[model samples]
Target: MITRRDFMKFVGGGFASAMALGGYAFAFEPLARLNVTRYALTPPGWTPGLKLRVVALADIHACEPWVSASRIASICRQANDLGGDITVLLGDYATGMNFVTRYIHSSEWSKALAILQAPLGVHAVMGNHDWWEDKTAQRNGGGTTFAHRALSDVGINVYSNRAIRLEKDGRGFWLAGLEDQRALIAGKKWKRKHIQGLDDLDGTLAQVGDSDPVILLAHEPDIFPRVPTRVALTLSGHTHGGQVRFLGHSPMVPSRFGDRYAYGHVIEDDRTLIISGGLGCSIGPIRFGVPPEIVVVDLG
Candidate 1:
């Protein structure tokens, strides 16, 4: 029979081992793992000999202890190597926090992302975090203006509730990039005045002809439900795959729709919604189960 003291010692050792493993999973694993997720999107009426490869990256919180300018550069190169016809960057380039945040200038992050290019072109949309000013860093007026200028300088077509037409191999489609829904409507400051210049889905669609295929780029997937059935696909990122997951299901999905629109592709009502897991961390800069990723969606 085992002695009582020996049993206690064994239990103590087991607990310590578990703590060490948990720390590694929460801290070290997240920093090193980067996944390239691929999806072949065949939207009912497949256009022959016409294909659109779009590489989507989002939530690149370029800050210390997590993402650096060098890491951002490497990510851009990785995205370029994917051979996408169009590259869409969903925003949140800067971290949103008042403590322990080592933020980089939006321009520097843009310089790294400048390496990304495609035949159709590169497009981007802003996120809610991008609109909040960095108090700790003393950055003025958020970072939207800087980010827009930086991305524009790098040849990226930054769209705010706008649609751009793209053609590939004699096939054409309209790509709409929508601004952050919450940023436009939410916030205590906006309470006094009506939210102007909101991202209107119908307004965006008005620019394109009815017969052409349409793809929407919205930062938050919560808007996915409001998207019309006519749209073939909607790409979004913001949840960051809940930062942690258990049993293949993330327990902390941050959306009004919860896990219903959490991450990955969901086909409902003749439309496809794809929410990227994203390429960086948020809050504590710790991720488990869900690693950084670049989403590659091929639409044909």
Candidate 2:
């Protein structure tokens, strides 16, 4: 028992709802929301009498209107207020979208990030965009990318297959950062399939000279499965919560494993990985369901 007028009304309501959702995804969520997500965990074999607070920012994709220097500075201030023992920049300071009003220079974004402070100082790792955007680096296939230079020039310690031992209040832990796994857009030959990478997890972990628990920083969570249990934690970004998530599931994740490492806390075979939803857009200026977030980890 359906009337034509009632059916028309139903269709109109559906159309309006669609438009509203589109507006929110395209405009509001990407530009308006910023959340602080915290995790407190005592990883297996964590050092006793040692506590560390880590504040991390990832996938800035800095650009006009979408992710501005002002916004970055504000994010820095807020992150500093969280009182982290160390602050880490998880990368992708370059613009991710093709459609943008104007591009923000690398120096501008890095300068904004320079304000982030911590007792252990600010450390950084380059993301895929950081490597891909540097035309010269890609052409050479082995040179310092602009993103690395930008972060380094600003006094941030950028790691590449390196590990450093950091001490807090008398206890110690090793902090390691792996080079981006997809540094080369043009994949290199690896048997039948082409592969992209600069990451060296085994070599990096080898640099650890002690039995101290390790906290690894990698730009993409794809390396999670390979991470050893000896490392207490791994922090990563790059998926941006698949850019559009719904009901805790992302249909289109950029990782090879799909939603397996799309976002948030992940534990596999006793190893731990924490992936940030990230603070900016990628591919397009849009976000739905998954809003931008800063991650804080308190480890003991």
Among all candidates shown, the one with the greatest lDDT: 2
lDDT of 1 by residue, 32-95 (tens): 8889999997885445667889899998877765787888998889999999999999887777
Instruction: Quote the lDDT for 103 in model 2.
Output: 91
Residue 191 CA displacement from its true place in model 2, Å: 15
**Model 2 TM-score, all chains together:** 0.96
What would the per-residue lDDT of candidate 2 be over residues 48-94, giving only the tens digit for each residue? 97999999999999998899999999999999999999999898999
Q: Considering every candidate listed, which one attains the maximal TM-score? A: 2
Error in Å for residue 283 of model 1 = 1.7
List runs of model 2 lying over 4 Å from the truth: 187-195
Candidate 1 yields a Cα-based lDDT of 0.79
TM-score of each: 0.88, 0.96
- Number of backbone collisions per candidate, in order? 0, 0
